[model samples]
Target chain A: MRLFDFFKLSRRGPTSADTAKQRLQVLVALDRKGGGGPDFLPLMQKELLEVIRKYVEIEEERVNVDFQAGTGFSTLEVNIELPSETAKMAV
Target chain B: MRLFDFFKLSRRGPTSADTAKQRLQVLVALDRKGGGGPDFLPLMQKELLEVIRKYVEIEEERVNVDFQAGTGFSTLEVNIELPSETAKMAV
Candidate 1:
């Protein structure tokens, strides 16, 4: 290693920027490899519907759970549509 | 410039890793400065409640919109509780 390279390493193991870079690298790699944002969504949606059914009567089709990645934030949205009086009393 | 440095620079303006690094740097920098997320959440929540209320009867207090950060993916969670029949028809 050159003197500058040696000095830079000697200063510290890794700066915050380096740590952040490594994390981002891992995230990008995982995303590209078809990873992340899985293994829990469908399960979560099922459980959520079960819980909502306790207090209100709604069909599985009325519940939606979505996970999406934003600029710097990821979003998990749960939208549950309660049945209207007529809809609930239909059957 | 050193021969190795000159060669690396002449190779390309920025590799994918470099671009990833720069993007990660910006994200971290914005996070440290308390600038990563904001400016659209409250508005979104308000609009969401308004839309939901049009079809169903739901109050704003029962809606929760949360923003959080995690290992590599941040999360924005929205949970809304629809009013049960008894509650809606109470008054």
Candidate 2:
């Protein structure tokens, strides 16, 4: 093995389990926030897009909205990606 | 009026309603994640603290856990604040 391989082997980088946990956590939050309706997401996305456009440019795909369900509540997660610094400055 | 006062007046910063919306979103997400049990929160908090302590030192108050309920699901929101760069590097 290469010298760097040792570090790679010893160091535990983020695993799929970690990603799954994060996704589940966000999903559960979204589910509990009354997010099951089909139209709600699209409508909310459109409105948010408009509001954000006023400040910075963002693509539709960059805006993610989802919901999750748990024992007693739901969660709605809204992840919006911002433009790069140069892009923002130019806008 | 000061020059900055005009900007402050015209520029609409985040209002209480925006905060409320954000809170409600997170709450709904948490509620849907089956976060209603009082015992669950403390137990989860303890375990999480143990895990995070291995990587970085964090105050108990910096970690916030909550839940919210909605139409068909619940959400569990876990917010953990990390130590500053200098602090982490020192560790």
Q: What TM-score would every model get versus the actual structure?
A: 0.24, 0.26
What tens-digit string does per-residue lDDT give for candidate 1 at A1-91? 1222322322336554444321110001001111222222223334433433443355566555555443322333344433332112111
What is the RMSD of candidate 1? 22.7
The worst-scoring run of ten residues by lDDT in candidate 1 chain B lies at B22-31
iRMSD for each candidate structure, in the order shown: 22.3, 23.4
Q: Identify the candidate with maximal TM-score.
A: 2
iRMSD value for model 1:
22.3
**Once superposed on the true structure, which residue ranges of model 2 sit more than 4 Å away at CA?**
A1-45, A86-91, B1-91
Docking class of predicted structure 1: incorrect
* lDDT scores in order: 0.30, 0.33
Off by over 4 Å in 1: A1-91, B1-39, B69-74, B85-91
Summed backbone clashes in each candidate are 1, 48
